[model samples]
Target: MIEAPAARAWPKSEAESLPGKLIIVEGIDGSGKSTQLDLLHKWLVSQGYLVVFTEWNSSPIVRSTTKRGKNRRLLTPMSFSLIHAADFASRVHTQILPALKAGAVVLADRYVYTAFARDAARGVSRSWLRDLYSFAVTPDIAFHFDVPLDEAIRRITLSRAEIKYYEAGMDMMLSEDIMESFQIFQGRILDEYHRLTDEFGLVPIDATQTLVKQQQQMREIVQPHLADIERVEGGDLAEVLRHSGLRGRYLQQPVWAEASE
Candidate 1:
């Protein structure tokens, strides 16, 4: 069995005392993180867990600034790295830390490791980026969905008309064509993620599997962590599924049942 990265001293002493568990799913674009996280959130809610969801770059403080910089293609690699770090810091204070203190399961779409990988790919010093995010608390469970480069690109391009400027690494000027640039840029990021898998002890999930299998793998890994959380009354998972436009009927069955059927 693959073990989590060797335990390191958590930066914030308060985080060590929190009763909640932090679970994170990370990968490049089109790796199915959001979909899997939504499923996990609903399943945990059905099991009477208090859950909070947070995503990368969702902090209000730096959203506009990052957007403007990306739109104008004005952000240097260092500036891009720092802006995302700022966004992460804001969320840690306002969103992550508080939820954990309240004993709520915190499901993050991406964490500081995302910065470590992407920033380093962009030529930032790995040690410097790690120090920049030294305040981040280690997640109880971190899964990296490993998808093939071609498959990820196919999924992303099929959904959108064209890849965004920054996502394609157009700023790096690696290729004259957008697709070529995206391939080169995302390939670098993917390689970095692979390196981080061993470095950080991220559980590798074969992302090319059917969604059902992926969710099953997620549940298996998450079940052990959920053992300590005391039950709590909260939102209805069925209603959440309905509101989110997921197939609501699945909530009637056990999570495993949904996968088997």
Candidate 2:
């Protein structure tokens, strides 16, 4: 099983209580992380494993605030970074840690590395952002979906009606054309992600491959770590507990004060 990167500080209380596994898929936008993670979640559940899925920027606490800021185009680079950090912190306490303590497999669509790449692309200091996320519990395995910038753009623009302002880094004024700015901006994030691969021990999955091939590779890597829990009979909570031999320890969810506007 892939362990958390050795450099990050893992809280002892969290370390001792963690009976569950956290698997994360990280990549640039349009890397198919959500699609792959959804399939993985379904496959795991079909095999009788309790899985909890979380996506980046889904925290209800920050949802409207972030959306409003983005709509207004009022978020500076540092503000955007901080807002996402708040969203992540909330999810870690409310969703990730709780499900993990319950012995469920936690599947994350994106992790802190998203911030590391995107914020740095917007000129935020990588070290400052990394320090901002030091309280996060690292994942057991973090997969980075590597796709070419052109390919990623083709996929996104083909699938969606239009790319949003901030999504194309229009706020940076890199180019008058949104598409051009997207290419240059996302290219930088992609390069930053490449650097992060070695620094954070991210397993790079070639995203240019066929969907079936990619899913097969993901399953092969995932199957081994879950061997112990795979034997549990499907759908009986009691049986699941008995088979996995989990004490079902509860995690004390952190009480977060409301984020100031």
Please, what are the lDDT tens digits per residue for candidate 2 over residues 1-261?
Answer: 433343343443363458788899989988998898877876776666676678889888899999999999999999999999999998888778867776778888889999999999999998898789888887878899999988899999899998889989999999999999999999999999998898888878899999888888888787767765433353554345435443332212122223111
TM-score to native of every candidate shown? 0.87, 0.85
Residue pairs with backbone overlap in model 2 = none
- lDDT score for candidate 1 against the true structure: 0.79
lDDT tens readout by residue for model 1, 1-261:
334454343466365688888899899998988898888877886777766778899887899999999888899999999999999998887777766666668899999878978888788999898788888878888889999999999999889987888888888899999999999999999999998888888888999999889888888878877788865545553344335333311233223212221
TM-score of 2: 0.85
Which candidate comes out best when scored by TM-score?
A: 1
Q: How many clashing residue pairs appear in each of the predictions shown?
A: 0, 0
RMSD (Cα, Å) of model 1? 5.8
Model 2: runs farther than 4 Å from truth? 1-16, 230-232, 236-261
Q: Candidate 1 — worst ten consecutive residues by lDDT sum? A: 248-257
Candidate 1 deviant stretches above 4 angstroms: 1-14, 234-261
